[model samples]
Target chain A: MAMYVVGHKIPDSDSICGALAIAYLKNQIGEEAIPTRLGDVSPETQFILDKFGFTAPELKMSYAGEEVYIVDHTEKTQAPDDIDEATVVGVVDHHKLGDLTTSTPLECWIRPVGCSNTIVKMMYDFYNVDIPPAYAGIMMCAILSDTVIFKSPTCTTADIKCVEALAEIAGIEDYKALGMEMFKVKSAVQGTPTRDLVMRDFKDFDMHGNLVGIGQLEVIDLSVFDEIKADLAADIIKLKEEGKRHSVMLLLTDIMKEGSLMLIASDNETIIADAYGVTVENNEVWLDGVLSRKKQVVPPLQDGFANA
Target chain B: MAMYVVGHKIPDSDSICGALAIAYLKNQIGEEAIPTRLGDVSPETQFILDKFGFTAPELKMSYAGEEVYIVDHTEKTQAPDDIDEATVVGVVDHHKLGDLTTSTPLECWIRPVGCSNTIVKMMYDFYNVDIPPAYAGIMMCAILSDTVIFKSPTCTTADIKCVEALAEIAGIEDYKALGMEMFKVKSAVQGTPTRDLVMRDFKDFDMHGNLVGIGQLEVIDLSVFDEIKADLAADIIKLKEEGKRHSVMLLLTDIMKEGSLMLIASDNETIIADAYGVTVENNEVWLDGVLSRKKQVVPPLQDGFANA
Candidate 1:
């Protein structure tokens, strides 16, 4: 039976590209794997795919009674609803360990890096498997998207080295220019629905039994959301009630400014207030130097919830 | 600060040698690491270390406020009681994923292999670090012990290949003779107390909130335990009550016969009877072709407990 390699819901560039690259690598190593996605591709990812001459992964939701290789994420909230029924054969992730258990041994390659593709690149080198040019191009774009063009705090030396190597294979001379072009597509939110923009890069976490939702939107300029902050806030409030979550937050991150405008809708406001030692005024706060949610946002919120 | 590399409480050959080899590899990569043991060294492991001219690892129980790398086991039950207070830097395991979660990303290398030392051997190759001859000799012995001289079902091509490569590095022409010599030392339970014999290779598990204890003793001849079966049964009963465990079972495995005589004392005997579809008489049953506790025993018992 072929194992379905899939990534988290609300898929981003890393989630999509990592699945495709990992599935390809597993197939090269004599394992039958099919890359699948849980959600629609974003504009940024679509641009990268078109530029690299690769097609989008097949969309799949249910995986009960099938074997899976999870990439990019390990949390149950981000997985398919019936993930407990599926057998996870392996996991290649770059996130904190989440609540997943297995009855058998598995191939687990988890590292603390900026992007999952960095670890996937290491796996390709470890197995002595050559990456195709298109795959390398797509993977390089994933690292660029994840690390915010090497400006995010999560960016590491491994990520930079991987991107440089991948760019050489991709025959791209100005990868940073390509990254800016992709970000230009991602920054366009004028006609997008408030809910769609919020759900694009959203993730839910179980913090001390409390369901907390967090979303991020990266753009070249933060001023674009000034006209729609109220709409985004209203949709975030609706999402909190719809999901029965304790809190929902969205980060409007400006790449040029290297900061975020955090919008909050929560049952307990102090959960966010005490986490970063900042005041939440008018349902929002400007967090200076907050670009990486996995590094700067989730950890403090998790600690705050633990205390609560 | 130097990270401490340690293993499970009941230190087996794989556990001890894996800690040593991983710590050595980490130090070679410019990280300070010290090998530590959770309990006293076993006779077989001590024999191998002495033959390889290596000292036993330091004995330490508490790891509060320390950074440590866990090897051989990932279970909270098998770890130190104060493990929650410590920071787990990484884990290199070869068992089913137990209930261990981290708040930060970690370097995890968990594979479905025969021995933790087999995974450690791969790690050495991954980092391009050369293993010392003494370490290679001990690691080869660990693979032999865990795989029952390549007779256990858990043994795979990877495990055999690792042992062969390690033997050449250790300058050992006939490693099978060394394995036999080690087994002779392991089979001597004549003068040991029944309680000591039972606790030598024992581990406790949390099965759906029910505490279960399982121990294994491998020998060339099963008849050596014939004279002490009743005494062993009494000790198991005492252990169950003392630890407030739901059950305590011991496996007297005959490596030559490729079977085990399971002596169980449980609050509900059907937990064992239904797991393997056997009839228990006088707290004793014979299991044919049951060699690996992890592969053949734990999964079935886990299922039975889940149903219960």
Candidate 2:
């Protein structure tokens, strides 16, 4: 039987390339595994897949099965159906452990790295899976997207090493340039919907008595953002009410120039501080060189929340 | 031993409450598996989670592990570290199956229902998991979200049954109000960013000889979308050029009483017509409730292209 790999909803660079890596590894190890895209392919994702000659997987919803192979997420706030299963194949993750089961004899791999593609590079090293230059380029792209080239709050030493190796394989000197190019493609609106323009791939978090939601959007011509700024805020307000969270944060990362220009429309700025460590400049968040929320923002904020 | 339950990213009403049902079932079976959120949470998700008193899940990258479990999502992108040694426990899921394998004995329950939560409710039925009235409300919401209350392209017969049962249990008579409330909460984008007001999540599909990125944005106020309409075409052009794709198709889904308002600003109007059976009108797309690109639009366009 072939092993299948599915990425999350609205699969980002990490989820996409990393799934390819795992499937490649399975193929290397005599397992039939195919990489698939699980959600609607965003423009950003399409950029990389097409550039690297890979296709996105089909849409796949989450199960929360009895036996789950937790990837880069934690288990806190996880429902029973999130993972209710008898068999788990593997878990390649980069976030804090929410509530990993302590008793299972599972090969659990949770790293503080930025992207799972970093782990895939490790598997390439440990398992000796041959890395095609194109695939390597994809993995490197995933790394840069996840870690923002080690600029995120979630980056670890492992993430850096993975990028270095994948970069070597891809024969690229500047990952930042590549990443900038990738993000820049998403810049500005010619005629895209505001809903589509606003980043929707969000995850839920909580602060002190505050339910939080964060969305990362990348666009060029930051001026265009100012034009539709109110609409974005309106969307956030709707999100806040719909998510039933007290706060919603949307970080618009500009890889072509300075750090991200954050658009935070929340009832409390403290939650913004907790999530981004950046203050609002006229209702817009200005984070210092933070490209990857997981690497540069999530860990510190999560830790700060724990401490706070 | 505690059971492991994994759910989908954005942990919607379906996944969260469905996760609860499976967790309750496992508890009845003397196993404690927890449902985990897969990725970032959205505002709508937070709303659903809080409405039922479920905390948001910690963010994760992916879930790929042997002997692991999942609920809403089943296709593994990246495996959790080691799966060969880990004993497969049990599984409850509601997504189309993909690479799911275990070297050892594993019990994986996969369902092709519309929502994983529906599957969990099924387990609730069999295991006699005590359904809290609050949870019943959440499950009803999940069913509504997944089935679009019998309006979505992905809906199945089982989704209707699950929602019907949950509605009865939750003592909900007028789902229209609940749905309207939810829609109001999501569609009310009075303060969202211009970019966000247009499109948040999108995908790329082939239209004629060019690849187009299509995004759908939902909003309640027609006036809010007024100012940014012009810039949308320019932005889509910029994005297409940067991403090296041609023809970005955008649809501004007006979720209010106005029905759906579409905007197509691509050089490929004929392409859109080739894909979507309806031709473009006034450089904008006009569809009579054809939303599903996968099921409704793509197939016809594919046929058109083949015929062409």
Candidate 3:
């Protein structure tokens, strides 16, 4: 059986690059695995793929009865549509374990580390497989992207070590320049559709019983939010009205400033205000020093929903 | 920051003994971990504990903020009430992964072996920690209980190896005799309240938005079901009326005969009849050669519910 290695839907740079790194490792260990994706590559991920001279993996919407290995995410909602029914053989992830149930026990390695590619680097060490320069380059890019160049709260010492070791393996003199190049691509969203822009790095959360959708878009300029704030608000309203979610939020993150301009569309404004202890003025608020949505946004929203 | 090692609620032989084994291994590795239980130990589990001169672990209903290491199971529903809020450190389980989400990544080892203790035996091997005779005895008993003396469909070659090795380690010349002793205690439900009898080994399932509960009680004699059939039916009805479940079923399994008298209480009897191609006679049917609820009962019931 061919094992399809895939990351989460709404593929981020870490997820896309992590899938490739894992597929490469699995093949080195004599497994017939193909790197795959559940969604289109985001601009940030596309930049990494182009930089590494790698093609985007074939997009698969469903994984019904397919033998697959998952990386970067383990949430059922974030996985392929038929992920629950798929024969999942292995998973390598760094995020919180989500509601993914497998039929039989599988090889799952979920480290509390920040980046999935960081864990993949450990796998390379475990197998004594030499990392190719291109693979190392993309893997290093994934770490920098997910950890926000070692600035995110999720970044750990292991992530830092992986960055240093991988940069050496990839023969990169200045890792900071590569990180800046990646972020420059992340911040280039001038002409992108508002829907694609919001959905580029989106994830759904089950807040108590409510389905909450949170999307993030990073930019160098905070004025980008001011330019597209009205359109983003309208799209959030449309998504909320679609009856799929109780709340839909977009985090327009200023990567340089290390803060986010939160655009929210929900029935309960007080709950949103109480979640972050920030007042909502016309459906927007500035969340200072909020770089990670998995850490900051999801938890408080879960608490708010629990209290509500 | 002590780690509390716990098993699922409605503690079974494997869950209880597995927690103790993992706690022992953790201590051997220089971790401050205490063995804890989510519910009262069953008669079979108690028999194993008594035979090994081990105390029942402290019962905990909730784990709000404690650092915990889970064994035997990983389902949120099976865990302590506040498991979602707990800081989970490590997990060693053999069952299908469930909806247990942690804020950070942790060490997780889930194998397809029949018993969780079988994986724990592997852990003992990996850590080069010596397994005490008493711990080995209890762990062997757990394997026998969960695997039904290697008759369970869930059992693998790893489980067989563990059984042989552990039986030798525990100095048991006749593993069958030990297995019989455990099953004897399992079959001793003569004086148990019907509600307690049914709930003793019960587990809940969310079958496509339907809350389904399936319980199993193994007996040496099939005649026990005749004596408790009406009472069991009444208790099932009471549980169904409680509105927590859409379906409630009890598998009164005869270990010697290798068959189960399934006593089901649900709004849809035709679905049950269709699931197994057996007619429901007075709300019960004999499922010959069906020893596993996880393998046989739950899947068909889930499919039947989906079709219904």
Candidate 1, residues B1-308, lDDT tens digits: the string is 99999999989988899999999999999999999999988889999999999998999999988998999877899998888778788888888878877666777888889999998998899889998899999999999999999999999999999999999999999999999999999999899988889988998877879999999999999989879988999999999999999999999999999999999999999988999999999999999999988889888998799888
Sort every candidate by TM-score, greatest first.
Answer: 1, 3, 2
Better of 1 and 3 by DockQ: 1
Estimate the lDDT of model 2.
0.60
Candidates ranked by DockQ: 1, 3, 2
Worst 10 residues of 1 chain B by lDDT: B97-106
Model 1 global lDDT (CA atoms, 0 to 1): 0.92
**Candidate 3 CAPRI assessment class:** acceptable
Q: Score candidate 3 by DockQ.
A: 0.41
Model 2 residue runs over 4 Å out of place are A1-3, A62-70, A75-82, A85-87, A100-103, A149-161, A171-177, A188-190, A206-210, A219-221, A271-283, A299-308, B1-308
Best by lDDT: 1
Q: Could you estimate the TM-score for every candidate?
A: 0.97, 0.46, 0.82
Report the poorest 10 consecutive residues by lDDT, candidate 3 chain A. Answer: A96-105
Superposed by TM-score, candidate 2 places the C-alpha of residue B97 at a distance from the truth, in angstroms, of 23
Q: What is the C-alpha lDDT of each candidate?
A: 0.92, 0.60, 0.85
Greater-TM-score candidate between 2 and 3: 3
Q: What is the lDDT of residue A295 in candidate 3?
A: 73
Which candidate has the top score in TM-score? 1
Q: Candidate 3 — what's its lDDT? A: 0.85
Tell me the tens digit of each residue's lDDT in model 2 across A1-308: 45456555456777777777777777887867666654667776778889878777644454433233434444333222333332345566665433333112233344446677876786676566789988898988888776655566566787787778878888888887888787676564546776666544565655434566777875544675767778877888787887787667677776545477667666666755755556567677677666765555555655455455
TM-score of chain B of 1: 0.99
